[model samples]
Each structure stands twice: as C-alpha cells, then as structure tokens.
Target: MLIVGEIHTALLPHSRPLTPEEARGALALAVGETVVQWARPVPHTASPTLLHGVDCRLPLGPKPGNRHADDAAGGSSVRAVGTVCSRAVLTGGHLLQGSAWTAVAPPQQPRRMPWSYYLARPGTLETIGNFEARRLAEGYLLADGQGKGLARKVRHDGGTALLDAAAIARHSVHDVLSRPVLDQRPPIKTGSTRLRWAAIADPGEGRAVAFRLVGNDRRRMSLVTGLVEPEQIAAAAEDLAVHDWLLSAVAARIALAKIGEDPRHTLRTLRPVVDHLLHLWSAGARTSRDLEFMWDSLERRPGLTRQWTTMTERVRSQIDYGAADLAAKMLDMMEERQKQTGGAGEPHYR
Candidate 1:
C-alpha cells in the first residue's frame, strides 16, 4: 500500500496572527463538515477534509535499472479511479498549508469498474494494472513532473485525464489564502514550500523514514511504520513538513547574516525569526506517539530541534536584542528558565 501526497506551507498572508474564530472561518471548506481546532500547544486549526474525484492515468513506477520514474513511460496507460483527499491546516494562526493525498491499492479485479463502485471508496485509488511501491515513490517524490508525462499521453489519446495532485493541493490553499479573511499582506516576503511524501505502513513494530531536500523549496520524505490510520500517517507527514519548512526558512534567513562580525545585520535578519517563526518550533504535537519516534530519529541525526534551539538562542541573545524592550526580554528569559526546569508548572510551549 502507498500513501502519496503533496503539502504546501507558507506564512499566512496576514499582518497578525489570527484568532481561533477567524482561523475557523478561513478553513471552513465544506458546507456541513466541522472545522477542528486545538488551543493547547499552540493555536492550530484544520479544515474539514474535502475530496476531489478523479479517474485518470496513474504515474508508472520506475522500470528496472531506471534511475527515475518519469523515464519509465511509453508503456500502456495504467488507469486508477478514486477520490483524492485535500485539507487546509493553520498552525500558530500564521502558518498555512494545503495537503492532498490518495491511498493507492492494487485493484481487486483486472478490469474497469462502474462509477458507483469507485465512488463508494472515497480517498482510495485502486490501480488497474501492476506496479510496485518503490516505483510509485520514485514517481511521486523524486520525479520532476509527477505524472506530467502520463498526463500528456492521456490527453493526446483523449482519455479521461491525469490527476495533478500537487496542483489540487495548491488550489485548496490558494482558495483559503485569497478569501476575504486574509489581509493580502504577508509579514515576511517568502514563497510557499512544498513537501512531496510517500508513506507505507506495515505489520512491524518500528518505523523507517527518509527526508531530503529535493530543491530549495521542494522536499521529499518517505515513511514506513506499523499499521495505523491513514489520517495518522498523513498527520505525521504534515507535522514533519511544517517543522522542515520552518527549519529551512529560518536557516536560509540566518545564512544571509554575519555571525560574530556584524551583530547589526545578524539582528536585522533574525528579527523575523523571533517575531514570526520561533514559537512554531513545537513539533510532534499533532502526530501519534506510536509514530512520533520519526521526529526523534530526525532530531538525532540531523538534529532538527537541536538546530532550532541553537538558532533561537542565537536570535534571542543577539546584540541589543533588537527592538524588544528590556522587560519583555527579561520575561522571555524567565520563560526559558521555567521551560527548562518546569518552573511555570504548566505545559512547556517549546
């Protein structure tokens, strides 16, 4: 089984963090469905998932000896029919994301099924032909244009069409971002980040995961874990994508500043980190503990949170602390102390 999807994350196009009410309004995509919100760790909201129906050619997995999946074309078209699921997520009321994915399963029979048969299985795509998980992963995450070649062929043949999973996700997010709820002004000048992922759940007791930057704004992560709900798997991916985006965004900004030579430039570049993104370092909050070990694994090797901690300290300890007043800085220091020692007697935000 393969769960393949794309995620788009960016700073919410707004001047200030949205309240729960406004956040809920922005993510109310479905007419009668509920929009979920969480207040504890940080202000977070999830739009009710919306499903898009698709009956089209699925991307072929790589052929033997092929380095990429996109290269494995010119074969008979493989058809898949089902619905693709998409949803909008708002974290810290400032980070926006659109997520879309479909669970791909080998077909039960060898031939095409009726429309009702496929409609009964929402969010699942049953393929009509043979394929492998590895090929699907390569095709979806590594290939430059996932399903683009197949899409063109389907169009040339005048078949149903090929689904653009990433485009579907982008549209979902853009719909929310363009709504009247947003002020059309972003606090920072940053483009959206995309994370393309494929996950497989098995009967094992442990998890195996790999995450890499395919490009500056594009990322790919593959996950394997014990049996769990599809939503749980997607949630884990979403959490990873958000933290990865935050890490990449902050790291990029920090890379432009001088460390010890120019405190002024360092402070100027990093001020946005503190004001906009530092508090969002909280990861794994939305993930299942059974699979949350993936984050721990990432932190161990690449040290996701460790790097975040180091950079946050650097930003906080910058010369003159930028425009923050002395009292606010002292309070922040005390909060950090309490965070390290449970001094506040409440849940730690970081």
Candidate 2:
C-alpha cells in the first residue's frame, strides 16, 4: 500500500493568537461536525476531516518537461478516482496547517469502477489500469517546476490532466487562510512551507522514516511503516510536516535578522521569533505511541530538536549581546560628558 499526501503550513493570519473558542469557530469545515481542541502543553485545534472527490490522470515522471527510465514502466494510460481527506490544524493558536492525503492501492478490476464504489472507501485513489506505486510516489514528490501538476501530459502525451493531490491540498490551505474568521493581519510575515510525503506499508513490525529538503520551501518524506492503516500513516506525515515547517520558518527569520548589522534592529526583527515560534518545539507530542520510533530515529541522526535548541540559544545570546552593547555605549557617552562638565549632564548619542 502507498499513502501519498501533502501539508501546507503557515502562520495564522491574525494579529494575535486565537483563543480556543475562536480557533474552534474558525475550523468548522464540515456541517454539524464539532472541532477538536487541546489545551495541554500548548493550545491546539483541528477541524473535522473533510473529503473531496478527484478524477484525473496520475502523473508519470518525477518532473514535467522530462522523462525518467521509470516513466514508461506503468500502463500506457492511467486514470484514478477517489476522495482526498483534508483538514485544518492550528498549533499554539498561531500556526495553521492544511493537510490532504489519499491512499493508492492496486487496481481491484481490469476496468474502471463507478464513482460510488470509490466514494465508499474514503482516502483511497482507485487506479483504472495497472500502475507502479513507486513510480506514482516519485512523480508526486517531484511534481513539476512550479510544484504543481503536470500541465503538459494531457496535451503532449495524449492523457488526461494530472490528478495533482498537492494542488488540492494547497487549495484547502488557501480556503482556510482567506476566511473571514481571520483578521488577515499577521504579526510577522513569513512564507508558507509545503511537505509532500509517501508512506509504504512494509511486512514487519518496524518503521523507518526518511526526510529530504528540496531548495527552500519544498520538502519530501518517504516512510516505510509496519502499520497498514491509512489514518495512522497520515497522522505521522502531518506530525513530521509541522516540525519541519517550524524549523524552516525560524531559520528564515534568523537570516532576516542579519545580526551584527544593527543590534536594536536585529532585536526588533527577532521579537516575533521569541514570542510566537520559540515555544512550539514539542516533537512527537501529538503522535501516537506506535509511531514514536520515526521521530526517535530522526532525533538520533539529523537531530531536529538539537538544531532547534541551538537556534533558540543563538536568539537569546543575540538579545543579551545587543542589550549589553547598547548599555556600554550609553555609559561611555554619559561618563565622558560628566568628566568634561565636572557634573552629571544629559548626554547626546549618535
């Protein structure tokens, strides 16, 4: 079984963090579906899972305008139909994420099936013809030059338009960000990040996760899970996406600070880093116990939390140094004026 999904993460477009009530009201996506809220280590809220239908071609190659050896491995033509599950997640009442995913399994019959058949099985994309799951995963992760769907396949290759699950996921995020519930006045301006993940069920009781970064705003994750459930695989993917987004966002802020240029300016630039981002580094806090090994393995090799701790310390050191430098300059100006006038007097500083 192959489970593919994408997550879009960004700061909630509001001046201040939302209260639990406000968060709940904003996340009401499905009719009569109550939103879930958690107020433990930090304020969190999630919308009920909603399903959207998709009927389109599954892309062939990893990228558009090119072909790989595996591009010709699948059937001559392939079409898929199913529902993609999506929802909005709010962490610490400030960070917002929109996630969408679908499971790709082998074709049940030689020909296509009815819409109701696919709809009955939520989050399962039914392929009409034979297709290689591994090839599909690669095509989705690489996507296109724009990280959208394969625009050329429908016309050039004589196939239907690519299904583009990532685009569907991104659209879900835009819908949430544009809602009237948000004031649209974010405290700080940071770009959004996207993570595309594919999890393959293995034949054992052990799991492994691999993460890779492409350029800056895009990420790809491949998971080998012992579990067969699509929901559990989706949960692990979402958890990884959140942590990766936080790290990327904070690192960008650090670069924007431009330390040593102007102490006060750097401090002003990083104020949001301290208030909104520093406290949200709780990894594996929301994941199930069965999936803890994935995080643990990451913590051992790449050391995600270690990087965060180092970055937090760096932010604090800059704050301390800036304050000390400002104080020293003030004291020097004041003392020199006193020496000249033989009495304490108001000092002017550049």
Candidate 3:
C-alpha cells in the first residue's frame, strides 16, 4: 500500500504579513522540506527523481468565446478557484505502510523536538497546500492506490474538465491551454487568416488549434508558434524540435563517452553529464555559445567531467540543505526588512 499525505500553507495572513514573492518562496521551501523529511526514513523505498513545481491560478467564468454548456443547462455560474501552489508526486516505497512504528510513530513524534514551532511559521501553511493539491491531482479516480478519487472533485467542468493523464499524454500543456471550445469557438476566418483551417479527424471537430514548434539549428535555437485546426495534421506538424534537440544531445554524450578505448558502460556515469545539460536548458541557457561551453568543458578534461558529475550531485543534495538554509535566510531577511520599514510583526498582505 502507498501512503500519501499533503500539507497546505495559507496565503491569507494569520499573524504576520508576507509579500507575494516571499509567500511564494516560503511555500516552495515548505513543500521541499516536507518531502525531504518524509523521504528520509524510507531510503530503500524512495527512488531518486527530479521534482517539478507548478504554480497555477484558474480564473473564474468563461473566456471571451468559450462558455460552459452546463451553465446554459441551468448550472450555477462558475467561480474562480483560489490559487494553487503545489508539487508533483514524490514516489517512494511502502515504508509508510506495514509498521506503525516507522509510519505513524516518526511523523507523530517530534523529530525536531518542538512541534509548536513547526506550526508557528506561515511557511508551514504553504507546504500543506502543495501536498493537498498534489494528492488531489494525482490520486483522483484511477482506483490505483496512488490516486484516491480526489481528481473527480477537484476537476474543472468546462473546457478543462476532460483534461487528464490521457489528454496530457496526448497533448502538450500549451495546446491544452489554447484548445478551442464549441461555445466560444472563434469564427472560421479572422480577417485574412483562417482559424479552422481543417477539421480534426480523431476528435471530429473543425476547430482551430495552436501548435508550439521547438527546434534548434547549428547557429541558434527557435520556438515557432503556429495555428492549425486539423487534429492529426496539427499533432504531427507541431514541432517537438526542442525535445528532439535535447534527446540528440543526450545521445551524442553517450556516444562520446563510449568512444575511448576504456568505454563507460553504466548509465550512472552519463547521468550527471545529461543532468547538467538538462539544468542548463531549463535555466534558459539556450544559446549555442552556452551549449558549446558546456560541451567543451565536459570534453576538455576527464577530471573536469567527473567534477561536473560531482557538482551536480552536490547541487542536488543542496536542494534539501538549501531549503533549511533558505528558510532561515528568509526569516532573517524578513525580520530585518520589517524592522527597517518600522512595521515589524505585521501580517503579510493577502
């Protein structure tokens, strides 16, 4: 059995005020710490993985063209759901199950010695919210123990209602956001441009669609956005150039590592190098010069490549260490800033 839990931090002030940036940062830190703490005891069960953080806000009511059919059928007006700051799944072993001592006892007991202090920080509230959202999003209605039917309740009912793992697997996030609805469908032609160029065969809708094209060349990288309506044509034509580029880079790295007389057999050797590239790309370091620098540094010296691996590992470790460090630093910063402004102890703005 998989045991899942969530933690949420309230944006609204309870005792002290926080800026939006500070609140967001605090929320992120709290979620990170909670996961680390949960994973500590279950070393064998938890697999190492990267975490993706999502901050989303769903606005109330329909956009200009798309209105919910349910509303026309006498449903209540849709309202904006509150902002959600959450982390995705942190999959691990069944350590939380089977033994009350390992599962309940540790969490119940004060690992840090003072439970009240843990509850006192507004950051704690943010942590809880993220955990709850993760639970609801991943655990909904699959009957798989990981999903607890929570997805059913939290699911949106309009254009976004049908969005689930299947849809996500089929479409990109950008596509999902830009999908057109029958109610608020744009005109077939807007000015000289045609909106619904062709009909989608699979979904059988003649609706227009937006496609994000990501590609890279020797000189530079590019992300071209296009609009198309035909379902199959759109899916196929949409450039996954960026993903392809990244994958090619990985393949190239693997090939290079295999070139020498003493070939590296294990993925562990290549994992760090690939991870470094991934980090750079994610950090918006897309220029050819940056990529060339990374490639050259890795290939320049064997020791440097090893050092790159070690550095990646160190940074990963710092995620846990840095959370604690950040929390403390933030507290100090907030306190000093508050003092300078002569508004110490005031609750943060909502």
Candidate 4:
C-alpha cells in the first residue's frame, strides 16, 4: 500500500487567534461530525475528515526507453479509484491547514468498482492496474505544472483522479479563507507552504522517515514504516507542514527587508513575527509515536528550532536598533531646535 498526502499551511485570517469555540464553528464542514480540539501542546483544532472520491488514471513518470510507459502516465493510462481524505486544522487557533491524502491499494476486482464500494473505504484509493508507490509520490510532489501532465490528462478524461490530493487541500484552505469569520487584515504577509509526503509500507523495517527540501519551493518527505496507518502519517505531515510554514514565513519576511529601506518600515515589517509568529514554533506537539522519528530526524539535521531562534534574535535586535535610532534622531532634532531658538522658554499648548 502507498499512502500519499499534501498539506497547505497559512495563518488564520483573524486579527487575533480564534478561541476553541470560534475554531469549532470555523471548522464545521460536515454534518454529524465533530471538530477535535487539544489544548496542552498548542490550541489545536481539527475538522472532521472530508473525503473526495477519485476515479481516474494514475500519474506515472516517463520511462527511459519508452516515451509513455511509466506508472505516472501508464503507457495507455491505468485508472485508480478511491476516496481521498481531507481535513482542516487550526494550530494555536492562529494557523490554518488543509490536508488531503489517499492510500492506494490494488483493486480487488479487475474493473472499476461502484461508488458505494469506494465510499465505504474512506481515505483509500483502489487502483485497477500497476501501482508504483515511489513514482506516484514523486509525481504528486513534483513542482507545480511538472509531473502533473499525466494526472491532469486523467482528470480531464475521467472527470476525477484520486491523485489530486493537492487540489482537495487547496480547496479546503480556500473555503476557510473565504468565510466572513476571518478579518480581511492578514496577520503576516507571507506565502503558504505546500508539503507532500508518501508513506510506503515497509514490512518489518520499523518506522523511519526522510525529509527533503525540494526545488527551493516545496518540502517533500517520505516514510518507510511498518504497518502504520495513513491517518497517522497525515497527522505527522500536518504538524511538520505547520512548523515548516512558520519557519519559512518568518524567513521570507526577514529576507524581504532591504538594507537601505527606512528602519521604521523594516521594524514594522518585523513586528508581525514577534506579535503573531514567534510563539508558534512548537514541533512534534501533536505527532504520533510512529512519526516522532521523522520530526527528530529533521530537527537534528536542519535544526528548525535553532534556525528559528537565530532569526528571532536577529529580528528582535533590528527592532531594538530601530527604536534606539529613532529615539536618538528625535533627541538630536530637539537639541538642534534648542540651539536655533537660543534655549527659549517652553511653549504652552491650548
């Protein structure tokens, strides 16, 4: 079985973090389903699972000798039928995430199954023909408009492809973003982070996860684990996406400042980090034991928190310098005016 998923992370549009009650209302996307909330690690709220039925050709990568052979394109196009799992999450009641993924299993029958059959197995996609976990995962994570050619064609012809997990996640985020509950004033001026992950079933290998920073835009990760469920993998990926977003968002803000720009304006730009984003760097807060290793591996090599601290300190120093510089300039101006006025008496205001 191959489990593939994508996560979209962004700041909640609200001026202030939403309370548990507000988050519940914001995440109410389905009937008879409850949004789960946890308070200890962070004020986290998750919408109930949303499923999208997918019945289209599996996207295969191009093969060396043959032009249209790989699983990404499927020489002639092999269809994969299954339900994609999606959900929205609020972290610290401030960050919002739309996550979707599907587990691909070889179909029990030789042909397309009934919709009821797919619906019965939520979050799983049954493919009719050849299914290669690595190729599918790579194709899904390929940079925008790259490996999507085959997947796009299948969706175009078949009307729906289970492999379009990213689309489901993007739409979920858009739904929350359009709601009136969130204020128009954005908290941080940053772009959203897209993370794609695939967990390939590894019999007796225990659980090990690998993280890769791909194409300078997206983060891709893979998990080779023993018998772990897909939902658990999705949750871990969600957590990773959130923290990774926080880091990337902060870094982008820092990089946007021009050395020659007005210090006050730069201060204004960095203020959001302190006010809204600094307290959001909690890693592995809600990760499951099976996926904790993934977080640990990433933290060790990239040292996410370490980099965050360095950036935070830099921002804080700049803010302090800006404040002091402004104060010194004001004082100098007052002294110059005093000299020009020959130390005149204090003026009275109405």
State the lDDT of candidate 2 residue by residue for 176-260, as single tens digits. 7767878889888888888888877766635778889887888888877765577777777777888888888888888988899
- List the global CA lDDT of all models: 0.78, 0.78, 0.25, 0.77
Off by over 4 Å in 3: 1-162, 165-227, 230-233, 236-249, 252-350
Cα displacement (angstroms), candidate 1, residue 34, comes to: 0.3
- Per-candidate total of colliding backbone pairs: 0, 0, 23, 5
Stretches > 4 Å off in candidate 4: 61-77, 143-162, 259-261, 340-345
Q: RMSD, each candidate, Å?
A: 10.0, 4.1, 26.0, 3.4
lDDT (Cα, 0-100) at 100 in candidate 4: 87
Q: Of the candidates numbered 2 and 3, which has the greater lDDT value?
A: 2
**lDDT (Cα, tens digit) per residue for candidate 4, span 1-350:** 78888888887877888889988988888879988999876788998898776665556555546644553433433478767888999998889999988888876888787789888888888878777665665555443333232133343444544355677887778767777788867777677778888888768666767777765558888788777788888898898898888888888988876534788888888888889888877889878886677878887888888888899899888889888998999999888878877899444559
lDDT of 3 by residue, 1-350 (tens): 11111211111212222233332232232324532223232111111111211111111222235554222122212111111112211111100110000000112222232434433321111121122221221222111112112112343532222111221211222221232221222211111100011111222322222221223221111111122221212222111222223334444444444423332232334544433344422211222321233234323543334444554554344444445565788899989888977985665778
